[model samples]
Target: MKLTIQRHQKGKSYEETFDVASLKVTTLLAALYEIKAKMDESLTFDAGCRSGVCGACALRVNGRETLACSYTPHDGDRIEPLNYHPVQRDLKVDKEKPQETLKRVLPTTIQNPKSKIQNPPLSSEDEAKFRVQTDCILCDSCYSACPVLAVNPDFLGPFALTRAWRYHTDPRYIEEVPNDSIQHLTSKIQNPVLLDTVQQNGIWDCTLCGECTAVCPQQIDPKSDIMQLRGESLKAGYSDPTLSTPSFGTPDFGGGFGFDPNAGF
Candidate 1:
């Protein structure tokens, strides 16, 4: 089998093809190792854990974001680094940008008097809200798949927003005060965390393209989480300027591409 790898160095990128018909290369990662070991030792890629749990082996396989450790290779497969980040080398991206964004969001319990109180029994519903969100491996596949980042770099990407939503919906964060009912959790903190997501380049900026969900190896749906965050933001009196009054009876207006539900188009 022949593998074509797109390599980058210093600011220039070029493709290098390697024939590994003699090597027992099944997975893409194995094929990459074979290339480095047998053909060109300069071939570069990222891999860790090799089991798909760490998400360190992320790459664009044949134009789709995937983990190289788990993807089976075929004839003439094209492998490259993820998009929306600076390429450090051949098939390796500088994750500092996404890592910094994730750090900036501080996806943790907002420090507040209420948040540090004695543990209250959490209802199943409360636990269920953030259950799936815990599965995020921070692979950045969704980050690469996001179309919004292509246009708006300032927009906080999906995983960060999903973590924000996870923290916001946390039982402790949204729970009522014991005695006199207090303002929402956002009002208590000097800097309400959720407020960060309602700004100009926040939840409103999300196109709901579903690409994030499509590429996630953890199966976490950041798109749905963003929608939930939008609802929470609405409760907080924030509105997106892009939203407008519904234009009914117009088939072309916002009708999704596919078989029309109304069957008029």
Candidate 2:
């Protein structure tokens, strides 16, 4: 099979093609290894766990996000680094920048509102609330497929928003604190600061395009998580900035036809 790879070196970008004798079940990572071992020693990419579990080998194949370790390569397949990330080398992208959004959005640890009770109990139902979200492997496939990042680089992308929703909905954070201390009573309320942080270039900025969900290798639905965040934001007395605009409502027609007949066309 012939594979065309997009390569970046020193400050230049180029394409290189290599022919590999591959079996029907040969994965893209295997093909890359073959090319690197026999054809070009400099051929570069990232891979770990050789299975899809690691998510370290994620890249763009045929202009779509996929794991190199799992996907079988077709003849004439074009491989490249993930979109919206700085290419470290051929087929390798710097994920640190994209992942930094998580640190900026989520608290270092879950803040238990019930201060009197250390290690609050979490029921099965509470665990199920954000269970699927916890499966995120940080593959960054969702980040690669996100259209929001194409235009708004600063926009907190899908994974970060999903993580924010994960912690926000955590029952530990929402449980009522004991009335032993006045400070505890005041802190019993939900985290408005988290909602506030996600309001700008965050949840509201998401266009609800399901691309992030479609590309997530782990089946984690970031799009749905973002919607849940929006609902929580509304419940917390926060509104979508776009919806609050003066131009968003229907125009009054003075009980006449939609348009004034007296006005000349």
Candidate 3:
């Protein structure tokens, strides 16, 4: 096996590789441990709750973001820290910023929590709307999977807004959602730094293609989350921020590689 990473050893980055033969490392974490214990002790990566509970071991495998705890290693696989965030050392990313975003979204309950509805009475119609949204683990996989984060670093990405959906969809929320909750959730949608983010760019950039959902180990559907934001924003009649973007500005026109349902060029 040969693994390469954007190594930030001491204070710099260089693509570093390691070779292994006669080997059988399962998870990416195990492979890194094997390399450290036997090959290069200085090599670094991050992992905890190897059962996939904690998202500490996130990395990019074959160019897609994934948690190393759940991802098995492949020979000649190019493994590095997440494509978006700075590599703390090897595969470990600084989750603090994303963590702060989670806190800001306030995606949970505290006082006077709504009683759990036994056989909750959501019409099958609403159930269909809410069911796919309750399964988020806050793994930030969508955050990493997003090309918005790759370039427009300040973009809120998918996790925060998706997380907002987790609570908003709760039938037991007890009271109306607070207006203060999202006063600024999309205010930064137009920040120049994040201008290139998806149509959910503020809440419209998401194609809802389920790429984030497909890669998530925890079954969190980031596409669903972004869609909820779009519906809510439109219901409130807020002008969609991306609509102001030049008709030609959409990546689909050219220059940027927006998702292509039709391709083969």
Candidate 4:
């Protein structure tokens, strides 16, 4: 079978084709290994825990983000590095830059006094709110598939925003303190700093195109997480900055068909 791979070296990009003996159950990662072992020793890609748990082998196969360790290769499959990330070499992208966005927006620690007493109690019902988001492996698949990043590089991509929602909605962070308390526990209000951080170039900026959710190997829906974040932001008194801009250019004539634009009419 013929497999074409997009490669980059010394700041130059090119494509190379290799012929491999295909088996019925051979995965794309195995095919890459075969090519590297016999065909070209210089072939480069990332792989670890080839069982698809490590998420290190994620790349674009036929212009779609997928785990190379699990995806089967076809006769003319084209493999390339993930988009919206700096390629370190052939099929290996620099994820450090995109991963840093998590630190910039999410709270570093849960500030619940109850955690000091005991591991803050979490009910199954509360856990259901953000449980799916915990499956994120820090893979750049959603980041590569996000259309928002194409327009605004500063916009916090899907994974980061999903994590933000996870931390924001945690019951431990939202518990309120009792007025007369012997334990001296303080109010565990949600982090205001996080709410402020996501207001700009963040949740409001995402187009919610669902592409991020489509390509996720974990089936984590970042699009839905982002929508929930918007609701949380609204409850926290943050309005969409995009809505503040005038949609129509008609003059406001007091009460005659002139409604307040800031009211979101």
Best by lDDT: 2
Q: How many clashes in each candidate? A: 0, 0, 9, 0
Q: Give the TM-score of candidate 3.
A: 0.71
RMSD in angstroms between candidate 1 and the native structure over all alpha carbons: 6.7
Q: Write the per-residue lDDT of candidate 2 for residues 130-203, one digit (tens) a residue.
A: 89998889999999999999899999999999998888777666423333342332343365556667888999
Worst 10 residues of 1 by lDDT: 174-183
List RMSD in Å for every model shown. Answer: 6.7, 5.0, 8.7, 5.7
Please estimate how well model 1 matches the true structure, expressed as its whole-model Cα lDDT.
0.79
User: Model 1 Cα displacement at 107 (Å)?
Assistant: 5.8
As for lDDT, the candidate ahead, 2 or 3, is 2
Off by over 4 Å in 1: 107-124, 174-192, 244-265
lDDT per residue for candidate 4 within 1-265, as digits (tens), equals: 8999999989899999987855333899999888888878888899999997889999999999999999998989999999889988899888988899999765655456546654567889999988888888887899999988888998889999988888877766633322434113222336555666787899888888999999999999999988987886676666887666544545564554445656764
What's the true lDDT of residue 116 in model 1? Answer: 45
The residue-by-residue lDDT of candidate 1 on 56-121, one tens digit each, is 999998889999989999988888899888998999889888877766655345334554456676
Worst 10 residues of 2 by lDDT: 176-185
TM match of model 4 to true structure: 0.84
For residue 155, give model 1's deviation from the true position in Å.
Answer: 1.4
Worst 10 residues of 4 by lDDT: 177-186
Q: Which runs of model 4 end up more than 4 angstroms from their true locations? A: 22-25, 108-116, 174-189, 249-265
For residues 35-137, could you state the per-residue lDDT of candidate 3 as single tens digits? Answer: 8898889887777788787777777788787877788777788887765666677666777786666554553334333445444466677666656555665
